[model samples]
Target: MMIHKIFPSRKHALHSWNFVMFRFAMLSLLFMMIAAGCSQVERRDDQYSISQEPQRIVPVEMPPSSDIDIAPSESTLSPKKEPETEFGIRLTRADRYSVNSILEKVLEYGITHVQLGGELITTVDDLILNPEKKAFVEAISRRNQSMGIHTYIWSSELNLEGRTFHFNWTAPLVVARQSAYRSVLQAVPEIDGVVLNFENAFLKPWEAVIPAGLPPFSSRERIRFVIDMVRSVVVDEMGKRLLVYAGTGKEEYATWLTEILENYPEEKITVITHASLQGNEFLDVWHPHFRTVGLHRHLLECDLTASAFGGMRFFNCLTDDLYEIWSQSRLHDVKGMIGLVEGEDFSRLATPLQMNLFSLAKMVFQPDIPPDMIWNESIQRVFGLFPASNEGQSLQALLRNSFFWWRRAGMVKGIPLLSYRGDLPEHADLIQPLKLIDSDALHPGIRFLLDELENPRKQTLIDLAQETLETTTWFNRAIRELEHIASSLNPSDYEWLKQRFEQQRLLANVYYYIKQCYWGFRYWEKNKSEEEALILEAHLQRLQQIGEHLEQQINSTDEIFYAKRIRDFVADIRGHFPRVILGWRDRQWNYLSDIRIKQAGPESVELSWTSEQPSISRVFATTGFPIFEITKSAVETPTLEHRVILDGLKRGARYIFKVQCSTEDGKVTNSGEYLFQTMPAPLL
Candidate 1:
């Protein structure tokens, strides 16, 4: 009250006010210093944040360099490796009577590995045993370059009177046979091993009938005897390991192998058996360590057979059925063994030849390759015997003629398509008139061939075409006869028959036409005749349209129709596309995707998805423990969403996440595989 009255001057009053302000400022500064000190103390008590602050303001501890480890760079890490290569074979055999011709043909076809049958070598053996003929035997063996012995004894009939018992698996007969074969092997040092067909001993009635008093041997005993003989030859005399392979069936012989192998460690010997029996009841004891012998027919029957044969087949002039079987069994690791059989019934052989030729044609022409099963089955049906018929001779002639034509067609068409030997060997050219009228025609054999030919591979086209064409020709003849037979019968008796015949005819024709178009296109392309190639192209389009229509009608409810349609469409385009252009797309589409993840925090997660397509988006997660919700709020941009996802999750918990993205068309554009993690829980 007195200060206002007593204030001497304005200046003096202002100075007094300034002093009061200065004191208040000092007090505020002191309070701020105390609060900052308290904050530092609190931070120290928290432990987590104390060391994270700058040391200039407050003292902070540093972790040891060893305690704070850095991850190794990617360059320091090892890379994933590829599988190692496995040694495999491409085997052939010298058929009896055709040894020289067949061997030459095999060599012509670039076949190196071969098995020389006993009959083929018998003549040579006779010469070798006889001093005068010894040089001839040596010369023949050297000339032929026999890879291995075909078989020591094909039948137990060697025990018959006409033939002195050359070999028996059991008793003294076994020893005697081994000694004989051993001598043969020793004489012919180039020979690899023997191929025995124990089934021959039991297949025929003459072979099956046994003498009343002779000591009986069980199937097991026979197998043991065979094993013993093999051991004697391989282990005793050769001083080296040798293959012991035999032809067997799904019947008793397959069953007998188990007991035989059980007595001896299978690893000690290589045993080759038919794939037909691999999965039968005897499979439990089936030893896989040894080689598995798969005939062409068995190879074509089942995919599993490929596994048995280490992925290969014996490509010989076996029955169509056998060839079909081999084709069906896709033994990828095994190469084909191609050879001509001596004294083979061409009618029987013709089926496989035609089928193989057709397959080759198909391979050359079609964009979509077929599998071996279809070809195998087709060949089997074509070559397999029908019920005894009065038309047997004529049928045989027709089949032979058809086979010849098919072979010719294959040579003409396949050579150009495959760019194979432009010279067109005379042997292939000689068989042209028998070319199947329509390689696509459906018959029992064609159907089988088609089934086998459904999945084509690089090595399969030539053989598949040859098989398919042969099957188509045989099927065409069969369908024609059925049509005629139906025409002769009463309406009621033959109505179904006629319908069936028509249906089969349509299928057969479709197959044959397809083949023809394929080969024609191939031939035209090879000759650089654009117009002819275009004609064949148009023909193929027509056939495909028909096939597509039929397929759609038959498979109305098919879930895979779109896939099949796309496949066929691509195939059609590819069939017309030149090989040079085709290889480009093949390389482009072979890219693979890889994913990696890193953790940022116990509760927070980060992920990245990378690929050619940047538009991909979508993520799926599955955790052993319940997850509330995955949020995309962390990512600000849509395009970069694929880079990472911040998942707020529980600490110390395990989790898995899967991701996928869709195209605007609703098709799956991309997918991210499963990921696992757990968030860290905060400490007290």
Candidate 2:
């Protein structure tokens, strides 16, 4: 039956506001059908599932060895790091200028160390010429001093310019580069100390400036350079102190650190490492490779004693896993611990500000509370799945998993259509501006054609959307559970919970729109009929309307923190539907099929494909691995026959290849990943 005839009773109502509700009802029915037929989507350990239980609170044990010869508090500064005052936070130069904000956080959290990251200079001239920069440094220094917080300047070996530096690593340097070390020290005399943030260079492959196919400078050279740099700073420049915060798991680097401590006076240097202590107390640890107990033993083996190693500190980075932070602080002879407070670390999570606030309050001020006791209290702080209202045996497990899922879908990372890179396609119909669809424009002729096309992959997308909707539905249920039991929360706690609740609601809306768009795409792709276009167009309008209403409601919300995120979410959602429509109209939808190897020669292969629509095809090939792992990016060619000759394959070796097609209009599609083996070497 034609769509118009199928909904003949509501044909006249299409122009009314009720049209949106009608479309939503139809879309929901479609989702119900697909969801009921689709098998359950596999759930990650962190995802919401009916069978999973909340994580349990596990007590952290002290290190095996007790002989970490920590020094007594020497002066008002206390050389040995402790909780509250010992916690440090690193900020960008932008954050450093936000003095009031920094001070507020410091005062609230009792933070004693503030590390400032900014432009790295190599020469005394570079430092002296930038008076504004020097003034900013001096200002931070004085402010931190008044607040009883020590401020350190943070710099990495691989400077921003993508050049190898002598002071950075053990690379051979001209006299000019040799003087860079003293220049940095002399330029920042007002600062308490400087932190050399040396880590494995392999982690930032993009930042490497070495020759093609060559790796970045190794951490071993960096460690050696640091040791010599510290010696020169103290001996030649008579630099009083320096801080080294290295997050290296390599044993060689740890051994090198041991040598630095044994050689240098403990009072002159402070070594800080990433503590990554957050989440569950049982499984989580500061170091990625081992537990806190194992880390302690490693340090002991390295002879990182209070008297031997001097000032040693550990910090939580990337996550605000406060439960373990409390435990780490109580470790014997451990100098100090720092916590991440700004940028990606904070922006990535829902309720980050509040979580950090609570973490700081408990860790700093409530030092008397035992770490394990605090862990127990914190486990119950966040909402759990299946409260008294739902079936649940484990509160901790629920809290842990909920936080995990919340992080996954909490924010709009990238807008689908508005965030396209490079130039947009010039398809006339695809690029047309969005407008409300007229019922008369519906064409049933293309619907029949669409019904004839077979696309299992398209059906798979619908299945995934169904699964995602199920996940979001459960998330919404958990949010409602929190809302129900939040009466006992204080005003501030309630506000935080409400903010999270609002974000969860926004996330659900995003998932719903995504499912709707997927269905619309399938509908349009199948038929491309006037009726199908109108149907898709109406769905687009419905999505925009939802975004508008959501924005209006959120804007009406008084005094909301992170309000901009919700506003951005609304914009992304509204902008996404039109992009998807353009993709369909422009034939950017990837449907490369009938791929087969025409020739598999000794060193090369010829491949061909037929797609649903004509497109500019590009092929990418890699050997024995994913194409993405290769250094050479994908090559593009507008294929007339949808064929390409791939050269440089080794005989008897396996290769993976994939194709991508984009229309002249802005739409794009990717082919399924393919793999094949070349014939063996020919007998000589």
Candidate 3:
């Protein structure tokens, strides 16, 4: 029966096979098309394509309201009501696709306000030339307004004709910028306000130093210009409500701010001031820029919320202290805080930014939220949970400890390091021994020349290296601990954890190289050893690789607030790397030795030390510690120390002491532990 059925020719069979193949291919094509359609459907939910028909731009002309309408509410700026906290974020770029995600985030965190970044527009050129940006601005404004989130345009000194107007108010560009701003306001009246980033130009690091034969720009003139702009645009034109970021300035500026507020009515203005908590003058000597009155004091004493202005809204700038800033702001009667985020990505934001925003929301609105719960949620979101184990817990602890130490290190020098651009002639004061060595720039936290330090024997360099070593150790330990936890995680989770910890590992690697670089350079300079030079060259190359890798990470992440700083750190490493130059001043290095306790008793003890090569007469001591034990903390000498006779000691108790010294050449010294046993008191 089979032979009879197969009597047809082979050609017939080939035709049948081709037909089947064609049908199968068609079916597969259809399935792929359907799958792609489904994928597009998902993206549609979160993205608004630019190709879609644009919204109608209806620019509003702000009309005068009746006195009753403008009248301040009885509550004024009080934050005790239903909307206790007004969370705002600064968006660096406004794109149509991001609108949905932003709105979703706004809904997620109850964000009440947003500051549209100035990067979108600078001069009249941007306004006239960039039509797409205009459309984008209008769309973003309308979208935000629809969601009941107020949006404001933010810009630093007006940029016009390629000239920046930050501190140079007298430039002709100021007048031109005023008209340009008006056009922008008319173009997007849906925007709630305009934040004038008016910081004193003279206060900026580059501007702070006056070059030879060039007089500094008149700060008074800059102030006058700011006042005029505020009066005209914010008060007279009434285009948008005024918001000002009066940065850390002197008492005169604060007084002037008070005077400026006297003229403007409340409810029409908000002042966002900088919070100096992390840079508290006592703890952070690195940040002399924040030496002025902090927001905590300004809010209370500046009379910003007084009845005269009908209680103006105040805000805190979380410059460094991420989560703690919210509580501090509320304590100071601040209505809300603006997360000073810098970066291009909001979706899947950087780990730090996500943590900061979540913490802010929890503190501001969800006070009952447990911190551990948040931590667990964050871990799950970033890296799916691994099975509970001792190693997992230990890894978590190590990661947390690493985070704390990293934050502490960054926070300690956040502001001062901010101002450290390249070692320009104007910034000679900041680079010690080469120029103005006695300047305040030589803070312990901001040792700019740490890696290139000339004196390897100097105790300051050793102490600095020790801190780097400790932090690096913590980072390394965290990376090792993560390995055990990784085994329990899925492939994706493991990869995510590795990527995150990669940052820490690289940081530790860089710090490790920093110490090596210092010692290598020191050896080369001391011995002119060809081997040491080669070592230094190799280390420098490796350091460069690590720095470039770190910079790439910084570039990839949308952690805007920290991106500049992280890059700056990389640049600093490069700058301090070994480079030969003529006339590089080698200041005499000073150190302390022969530290001896001349007298020891129950009631008092005499401590003495001599500077081998005197640089300064200062000496520092640590409080009583166990002999041969690591001192947890030490206090700087309140005044010069020749011989200190410490009084009121307890009898029959063992005490340990250590001494440190500073020099005019900006070098520091640390003497090892000096232990003494107090004799028992005589029978009274």
lDDT for each residue of candidate 2 in 282-399, tens digit (9 for 90 to 100): 2222243333223321211111111110101111111224434444545534444555443222321224343444555565556555433443444444433233333222333334
lDDT of 1 by residue, 92-199 (tens): 222223233333343322333343333323222232223332332333344433332222212121221111222344434344344445554555453434444444
Q: Pick the candidate with the highest lDDT.
A: 3
Angstrom error of the Cα, residue 556, model 3: value is 9.2
The sequence of per-residue lDDT tens digits that candidate 3 reaches over residues 1-684 is: 001110111111122545544544443343234323333222121111110111122222211122111212121111212145567776643333344455567777777777766354332224323455555555666666676667677655433212223444343334444555555565556656677665522122223323355555555445545556654654457445666666653545555555455554554456666544323331122123222323222221111111111111101112123444443445446666665443323475424455556666666676535445555555555445541546545644554444434432221112222111111112212224333344354444334534334445334335544334444555566567777676666666466556655554454455445445545455555667555555555656666665455446554432222334334543554465555332232223344544456455557777765655553442333332221232222224333335666667676444556566665566665543333545556757
TM-score, cand. 1:
0.30
Q: Cα RMSD (Å) per model?
A: 41.1, 25.4, 20.1
lDDT of 2: 0.42
lDDT of each: 0.36, 0.42, 0.45
lDDT value, residue 82 of candidate 1: 13
Clashing pairs in 3: 157-166, 342-560, 342-561, 343-560, 615-664
Which residue window of length 10 is worst by lDDT in model 3? 1-10
How many backbone clashes are present in model 3?
5
- In order of TM-score, best first, we have 3, 2, 1
